[model samples]
Target: MQPWFVYRKCSNRSCDMCIYFLVLFASVCLQVQIKREKALDITSEHLIKAMADQMANEGWRELGYVYLSIDDCWTKKQRDPNGRLEPDPDRFPSGIKALADYVHSRGLKLGIYSDMGNYTCGGYPGTTLDTIKTDAETFSSWEVDMLKFDGCYSNDTEKAIGYPKMSSALNATGRQILYSCSWPAYEGGLPPKVNYTQLGNICNMWRNYGDIQDSWASVLDIIKWYAVNQDVLQPTAGPGHWNDPDMLITGDFGLSYEQSKAQLAIWAILAAPLIMSNDLRTISQEAKDLLQNRLLIYINQDSLGIQGRQIMKVDCLGVWKRELVNGQYAIAVINMGDDGLPRPFTTSLGLLNVTQCPVGYKLYDVFDRNYLGLFNSETTFNLKINPSGVVMLFIQPASVVNHMKRHGSYFG
Candidate 1:
């Protein structure tokens, strides 16, 4: 079988991992808008700046969590007198340019939100074809590093035209702003409706499913959708492009500890973007550890960039595997049962598609950070996966490690 060559290493300064956080601060403001709270204490500038500061202070910046994104409701309900979009004076007194400057000073990139329709999802002014050039230029001028263009209040025709138009418009500005599109998600996220080739040509990443709500069921739904659509989605994802399953709500409400690990592990296997939609200010320590797990992040950002596939699924057990550079592989076994007990599962290297391991395969339990000993093609391994949980392992062939060491190249 030919290995899917969708991933390339990002050589640009900030695009290395492109790990980002769609701050839950934006979610809170959206809730405030729905509740009609006009005078919230956390201003847009404060919220975004605080997130950037936390990334810097908490070591998240070093982990490649560099893009700090501001979602909807950051703008005034009305455009300025000149028709250019303006930040809400009360919420963003310092203005977006200044905020972008601040984020950049911390070595972080700033991502802003907008819609390709008459109005944003929150009913703020959106960018139409007429305003696409102006909005793109404005964002570039502000040094915005990323744009999360949403699909709201727009029909299919408008999206088809506007999405690529905006991509071209952003390119015309001469700034390298990452385009995060919601096109596929709105167009059923399937082959007939979504042109994966065209999407890869234009977008840096795309949402391919419904918004991930804060629930175990929501996570499972996304996992199932991506797993079922892996063949189509995997081939299009690589260094510059990715299939976004929406935000990681792991650190937020509605997930248990094991469930959080499952979300993180599977997202890594899928090579999906690790955009956290949780409140960084008050996230629990356990949740924070999972979010900042370096081993998982390494797998997710592997240069090989091969999106994992569901090797097998039977009853409550689902297995996934992603190929990595240096002949390494990642395997994730998830228990989707809700029976409140660990499900015992058994499998071997041969079943996992390991055709050959000349000196046996050394397995490392990434979640527990333990060495699980060496095994071969027929070596059987047993796992007791907790309900609503996952166990992820990294497989490295001993022969490859020995060969690399003989050649004086570091394999670890």
Candidate 2:
């Protein structure tokens, strides 16, 4: 070649050769566009009307899988002799189809429960010995929007057979229903050899943990595990498919107001599905406010499903942060340990690659709706965080750094 095209100026003084590696690298790596999906899991026992009303009022368009889902009581001692799935009339008085229609009328989708084994978790009859096609067709006929498949009585072989069988049946119906695999994460079902990526393609979301109890400790423990395991399951999460973290415990489950806020903040940061498990009809004002925090909800619904991670830890003062796709940063300064003197914590923008060591950025406290003044060479701020409380921030590019020293601070 006579001459090489150079797109970027050479920075090294000793180099004279025209380099095009950066351009070539950029051209080779294609950016994959991903869509994000918001979901809420509700039990059948929850007040369906109230949940629908609240979701509609709060601007939540999608009412994920609405059925106080028949955890175990929605079945008889056994299936019918004709191999048809039976419904407990006592619980579902209007029948499954009528219930689905009612949910649909309220602009919500109905999700039901099933097991791959002979019985469900609550000992109800499952589709183990029955035809998968028929069971799936039944659900479709009932207008079921989602299915939560349990592996309670399923053996290792059944686990392999049950999921695929149900998937094929559901697909055959030509109805779009979200399929959720409820296999515990610690279980031996998921592995690289089993090709979980393919499974993810078939199911909308899969549960990696058991039922999340209603306690701060339980919630924190599950969140911690998800933070550590997110990278491992990243390939299986996106618009249609997500790594489910179970339902939310924010509304009146015996958690303190501070604890509920912490839970909501953490769940939003994790990008977990926003499923409410409490009785929405009788919830308190504080509980409703915690659930209806739109600012935090937006973070969870960000197109990029990048979960936040703990950036720095100062004993009980834990700082977690995430980078949004819009060149913004979401930070959570939390105090999870014992309540001592209010501790001050700072998060550096340098850690998020937004700026180099010699440059700094500006941050806006989204929660408090206040501006944190800029710092030179690094975006650093201090906040007094109490136990089980959090201070959330959104970091943006420094407006003052762009040649105008007159602008005091644009964070507000």
Candidate 3:
């Protein structure tokens, strides 16, 4: 008998037993797959404990996979005689598996790094052009949950096939590990292609752009570019698959609190993955608040998983919007001008045609948690958005508004 047949026999016999068994089996399979893919990437292993602690304290319940992703320089130039990738003893003297266990004990997952070429981006040895299967198995034995596969030294002649080959090797291990393709799209004369569907078929997420630096221009350019091409990637992103725009620059960068908030806000609107990139061990309270802005993060994690798009643009002023699964609207009014003070901006709620009649709409400022009373059929509000900052609001049906008014004390 098949393995599933025995599992079915062990369950209580009911008319729906067979169907329930099949569903249960499928659900288990899917959970295993998703467990492999869920992840957050980190570069500094030194901050592993602190990162895990912060995530837990902030009520981040499902950070199942905490990838200790070694960006570069975490390996030696040669594998050991046993054919396993050797870690830089100076940095990880306790061995990789010990670190993986530490993360696992904290209720997080672990990940590692390798390149497709003979050497890593930091000139360490890569698994590419070598024993790919063996390298994958080594990671599996070490309890790695994710792998960031970079295209650092991969030759142009081999780049196209290298990623898929590594993915196949990882899958062969039957260990259910996530593969992150880090091929910089801008290089190699490639088209403006983010083939998320094809990539998602094998890997969890792929870097669609180059390295994201800690600069406002870097963040702004990436967001603008992604907004224009988001439709092309919509089909590929969902609960299990995502389009990674790279890591969040929230904590220890030179950015001010306002700038960090702006970065987090735009990224959340874009539905970008929230893998943080700063030294979390000593992150400041302001930085932590910026990273854990519940309202903004909720927009990113909305069930709809729809990336926000630019609905309107004036030279230095813009409006971007996304729809939540609960029939609410998330709108952001952005000011790109140089002025430091907040400037007034407005957008028509009717243009969104949110309600069946495009009338009787009530708005709530998501940031301030204050409800703005009813407005005209073509609802508009003068929002004060700081330079490169946003005024985000959620529009709800008038019924919700009435309910809130009737039970104001209850809601409070």
The top-ranked prediction according to lDDT is: 1
Which residue pairs come into collision in candidate 1?
6-238, 7-238, 8-239
lDDT of 3 by residue, 306-325 (tens): 66777777667667788775
Please give the range of 10 consecutive residues that has the lowest summed lDDT in model 2: 20-29
Give per-model TM-scores: 0.91, 0.76, 0.79
Provide the clashing-pair count of each candidate structure.
3, 5, 1
Residue pairs with backbone overlap in model 2: 41-275, 43-68, 44-68, 44-69, 45-68
Off by over 4 Å in 3: 1-46, 57-68, 184-194, 231-236, 339-341, 357-362, 374-377, 398-412
> Can you write out model 2's per-residue Cα lDDT over 167-283, one digit (the tens) per residue?
778877877666777754436334653456666545555777767888877877776676566566555555445666777777646577777777777766665566666655567
Task: State in Å the error of residue 352, model 1.
Answer: 0.7
Each candidate's lDDT (Cα)? Answer: 0.81, 0.59, 0.61
